[model samples]
Target: MAYLTQPDYVKYICSCGQLKPITSLYFCRHCLKIRCGFCICHEVDSHYCANCLENMPSSEARLKKNRCTSCFDCPSCFHTLSIRATLVQPRQASTEASGDAKVENKQAKKMYYLSCFNCRWTSRDVGIPDQPVASGGWPERTNPFTTRMNQLLEYYKAIALQEKQEKLERERKKFAIRGKYITLTDKTGLTGAMARNIAGLPSTDGGSSSAIANFVASQASEEVEELPEDVYTKEVNLKQITSMAQRLASPEWQPAEVSRLHPLAKLLSVKRSQRCRACDHNLTKPEYNPGSIKFKIELLAYYHVPEVKIISHESMKPGEKAALLVKLTNPTGHEMTIKLLQPEDVPIVEEEEQKSIEKSLEKSLNLEKDSYSWRAICRPASYSALCRVREVTRDFTLAQRDDAAEYDDDARHDADDVIVWRKSNKLALRLEVETEASAASGAPARAALALQYSYRNTVPPAGNQPHQRNHTLYTTVLLDLGHVI
Candidate 1:
């Protein structure tokens, strides 16, 4: 079994100079380059409640402060509160008071209250009443400073609007230029207010625009409320008080005592989609359903790039070459021809080629012209030091992956000195690694390797040019050998 927490023995160098494991990288087919988390754009797709599996639109989510109405969290233990039902006996009138003998009838009413399964905390702990319905009939607390908060919000909004108008006027004055041709409005001497008056339309200026209310500035009072005498004289119980986290969870009241803590509305979770900044293609996108773990598009580097794992290596000494064994697995459906070379031996992508690739990405900035946050995508090339490997050693071929190949009996194989063993899509190799003579004892044993492999581009015939598939791609990886003995 793969260990959940293990140090990375093999790491690949990404196009943007990042060294990451195969699992943490993404492949952009449009740009034919590897991208990491730092080079991708994240966007929120939907908001949802994990426990209730209730989905909400973005607007509704914002209006509700990103909380689920029917679900709640335990204010004591912060666990999901489950609804418990109980039978409540109704009150009945006595026959002696009515002066008539009668058969009294009453039915038990079922009531629901929130309880935490972990902490054994119920609504009765905080003196909350049980509800007749199982969900969404609980009374909500009203904030004492709601009026002040609204006034502050309106004041800030109006200030922002005033600042925005002033900035627009400044920008207009700075960039203003005379047009070559005179407009009919300018030549006919018709101003905006004059035109509005002539057309019998209301002028969109001052109070005529909308009902702009004047915000009352809050006043500071000199007198302070006296604290309870028990706060200073009486012994305090920490168990009956709320912690900082519990208080901040409900910011409106921020109750300091346990009795004031109420069942908190569950915060909503979001499903986000990731896109490659350079190619403008989706790297990973989840399904719209909150319960689904599947993705609509997942271009993980592990699926596109070959995986290399260090098996074993002979103990290394200064100035001596050590024998290293590594296993390579082709995760693709097609057979791959891989050659080991020094990093410098890899082909350098020309400037013209890079420009052509960017041109092929063909992202139009026109669509984002009005977007305030939009900016041109700029992808930086990988910065790497050439590996010191001596020679090519030799090239080898790995067979295509076959699920049924695992069931078949061991097949006949040719004996090769370089290849240690051969399986369905995996091959093991014995290679040499050299350590520097002047290297100190317990120094790190490191080696950089470049792999030249034939890749088949699956860029379909979508926009332009015929689909030309065959291409040779190059990747550089760094290996961490055991420390020199």
Candidate 2:
């Protein structure tokens, strides 16, 4: 069993030169390389409310400012607010009778109020009336600055349209030097807002000559409202005042006193998908449902790469050789031929297409040497962790992972020099490490191991390549030794 508090003793070198644990790394079958978060692209797949498990389209979410209409959060504690029902009894008057004719109804009507279980806060505490319906009947407060905000939004939209027009006109002249093509905008009588509408952009102030002509500037007052006289003499209570965080949570009013605090609308959560920047292939895509914990497509490094675990190791001393035991497991269904190589002896292979990417990056970087290129440069100086380690090479073959093999107790023993034991798809190897004579005492003796293994790529017929499958891949892992005694 793995402990949550344990340190990351083994780290893999990502193709983007980042050193990350297996949990955070992803494997791209198309590129046959390991990728990290820094070398991938993320895009929003869906928007949802975590509290209510409600999903909405991105366009609607944007229009609503990414807030859930039914779900609410506690203004005091920020916890999810639950609907609590209350009963009320009132007298009803007969429609055809005189003013004195009234009927008493003991039957009660149920109303719902938002309540926070964690903080004992309720909607009635802030003077909000109970809702008739539990889900959608809650009253929405109008923003005091709504009119001004709408005016500003339209003003900016008009300005953006004007700038887009100027940019297009400039680009047209720059490209029209061949004198072959003329745009419909120049031929038709459309102008200003109409032309912007034809280009799929917003109309400019509904054909107004200028936005400033319609915009009304706010007036400044010379007189100021003074605070109450009791404010200076009254004793301050910290509990009655809202904290900075509570004020910022509801920015519309930003009430300062606890009495003015109201229930906050719950912010919506979004599901995102990540893609490899190099190949434009999705690395991870989650299910659209908010309640699901699974993903539609997940390419984690742990599933593709072989896992290595330290079993035991002898104490190390300066200028002495020590024995190290490590167990390797083949996670893939296909048999893998694993070869261990020295850190510096491993070769990095790139396709002709990827090589061109390097030249393009170099051109963008002004041909600076030693400076890291974009996606083109994967293995960086961080891989030098292996260069500091000294170890011998070992080669072995692991069987394919079989579900029925786990039930068989009998183990297979190999006669190889490094093979210690074999059970199913796992192989335990006895590795020897030699410490430097001049190595400082009490310093950690690090060891680096590179694995060149056969991988059966299952990514079928992606883009133009239909037969690109089965390849040899290289990955480097680093281990930390306690210290030289």
Candidate 3:
């Protein structure tokens, strides 16, 4: 018989080709195979401005390119630009006392500029003027490339028109083979010259005007509207100014100009991506939005580190405690904090071996470790010829039966919630095994131990917001033991 604190059997080979515990393998149904972080591809799709919720399409993105029209980066450090405001006393009218004094306007309402506090990059640096009010109502600037852009746009339009004409010509020829295939002009009792005259397509260019005149005729009308001066006035006083501005304006602030900042700075962008170091696989892409503190997560199939092993045990008498030891290590440079997320929180593995046991014991273990942690799970696997397994236990250590909180829908899952609490690398545990006379023929029985850990990745997101959010890492450890009870 199997006892509590012990598993019935352990798996030998990982779903991947490597020999690892059932815990260390990730089952991928889409690929119908086990995958380690070593094999996958990751790519970034787009970087958007969160405040405006205006995402740029990739093609348009390449041209507008360096800076977003709606979004601005600090010119000094290139960090995402945040809006800031200052209240001015509005120059007080100085000649108010004299009866014959000239009338003075209310202290020419003071004008303050909106600027970036991080790198001393002011809206003024990019020629962004101050607003009359604290928020909104900033002047919009037309692009300087308007003329060249218009020409390019027209060129594409013309090309599209030419392609359409060619397609129509092809269709006409295809249909010509069906019968007499008389041309439209032939059926209508007209020749090519007559048809060209009727269709409005020029057969010759001898009488045409200058190319510039033709271009002018084909071009759309241009109209420019200017905003009234009153529209630039700041009607409302902006009360809250963040400390970021003061920090940015401080003379002490210095940011590195190297490309190394690319990985970290990209996190500030609405959409961020990172490539794996081992295989250069892109592991996570998050949609970072400034207006809201929520984000979208896209976890790639690769990049899951794994652990697998085989455990053996002797015969088991009823009610005896057994123990198994498994070790975990991080292969990446950045610190990774972990927890044992519920099985539902993890993606399903598609292997048949993974599905053999339905409802295998599992639970979330609240953790508190920073880069690494250790804990134990207690279970009994004796009488039913089946093994009982539980999730990796951390500090939370709930009982066998208790209701736990379900994961909330917040776009941001706090990093502090799932870390494990461990002062040292070592962890201790006890397992009990029981045996029955029928199976006491002296043959050793076997059981499997499954362990899971959920961790937070230290890598930063790819776009503008480097510190926006954290990526959760999940891994499993498996051990199998056989011996007498």
Candidate 4:
């Protein structure tokens, strides 16, 4: 028999039907099947300050609450204090004669103060005890707002939830009375109340009078559930909490201006996740850290806007029609609709034989520079003379601007990136011609190509974002002069 490899030890199935690496999956012998970080429970084995790394026993840790005993947040700005120490000279126990005798003294102990540079907060200023070590010796503080804020927040949350339940009940009744269909509960031999109970919601058929009275009693009670004493001991200093509240409430406050900060702030920003590559179960969040780890969340900046640009064809023969193209792209994560318009001077026209070229040329040609001239004759010499050119435009969308974005403007002339030329809106010209007809035999031809393009983009604001106009107009045209061939 041939021995088989362990079938990729890293690849394993979790209880939640998600395929994840063994590194990300944990084995729960009790649960049998593989357990991923997402499906398993997280119980903190110990409580310790990140700065001190001194693990404390559960019972003792509970006594001081979960917070570190030696550390404290700045009351003014809530930043962790950095302990600093200085050495001092020790005095001898007995005095020695200046020149006759001398005595050896013991080494002196140094004292230092911990300070918060961001908020100018200091431990010495608040009367915290000095520690032998420079780090891991901070004082802990308790927040006074803890009780009131918790009570207020819970009260509003409960009120909102109760309102939602009431609205859902009304909607259910309306749909039920329609009689067009039977609900799953009705077909399963269960009443709506029974289903609601199974779903963990309170029964809705209690007497109106009793329900109203019960609701009133519940709302009148202001008491909030108390946290476990051990958890409760993890108190936040009132001063620090107050400072944070003020900063949050002030519209003018900027995070850049605030100084004091916890050292682990960046570590908290690291996003750790365990995902089941196969099933994508617990789809919203396949991996989550235990409640013990206090994770931090923040928004940096939003990137959502459409980008656009234009390109023009190189200089063409004096009598030939010039062509140009415009490209638009959406650099944002969302899709966008856009519109483009041709410049006023560059009107859309169809190809046609030249008409009254003599009159048109007479109006455009400059007599002062008429040393030479050039002319374009249609395949059939009988065709009418060409006088002006026509313009054209198109529309499209671009996906997110990732690393692959590339810009190509090879067709544009060296003189200018933009161009503008006049033409009839309804009629297309075979081509526009501006040549110096020789006042005498064969003169030299010299003329400039003038072109310009104009356009508009339409995009809607994202949800709840304030209505604001955001679009840019790029206008530039090139004028190149060359000898007529």
Q: Which candidate has the top score in TM-score?
A: 1
Model 1 lDDT at residue 63: 95
By lDDT rank, best first, the candidates go 2, 1, 3, 4
Task: Please say which candidate is ahead in lDDT: 1 or 4.
Answer: 1
- Could you estimate the TM-score for every candidate? 0.83, 0.82, 0.33, 0.30
Give each prediction's root-mean-square deviation over alpha carbons.
4.7, 5.4, 20.9, 25.7
User: How high is the CA lDDT of each candidate model?
Assistant: 0.78, 0.79, 0.41, 0.39
Q: Looking at model 1, report the run of 10 residues with the lowest lDDT sum.
A: 369-378
> For model 1, how does the per-residue alpha-carbon lDDT over 293-388 read when each residue is reduced to its tens digit?
999999898987888889998777788887888888888788898999877677765556435335433454433432222223333334432114
- Runs in model 4 with CA error above 4 Å? 1-113, 117-121, 131-137, 177-182, 187-485
Residue 404 alpha-carbon offset, candidate 4, angstroms: 15
Per-residue lDDT tens digits for candidate 2, residues 1-485, read: 56988877778888767777888899988777788876666679899999878999999999989999888889999999999999877667455456666665567889899888999999999889987888887878889999899888877777777787789879877876453657665555455667687799976445543664687877999999999999989999999999999999999999999999988878989999987766678899999889998999999998889987789888777778888888898988999989888767778555554565456445543334423545545556463231133454656788999999989999877786688889999999888877777777777767788888889987686467667567888898887767778
The candidate scoring highest on lDDT is 2
Report the C-alpha lDDT of model 4 over 212-319, residue by residue, as the tens digit. 444422256678888687766686655434344535433233222223322211011112332222222221122133333543321111122222223333343444
| lDDT score at residue 27, model 2, on the 0-100 scale | 92
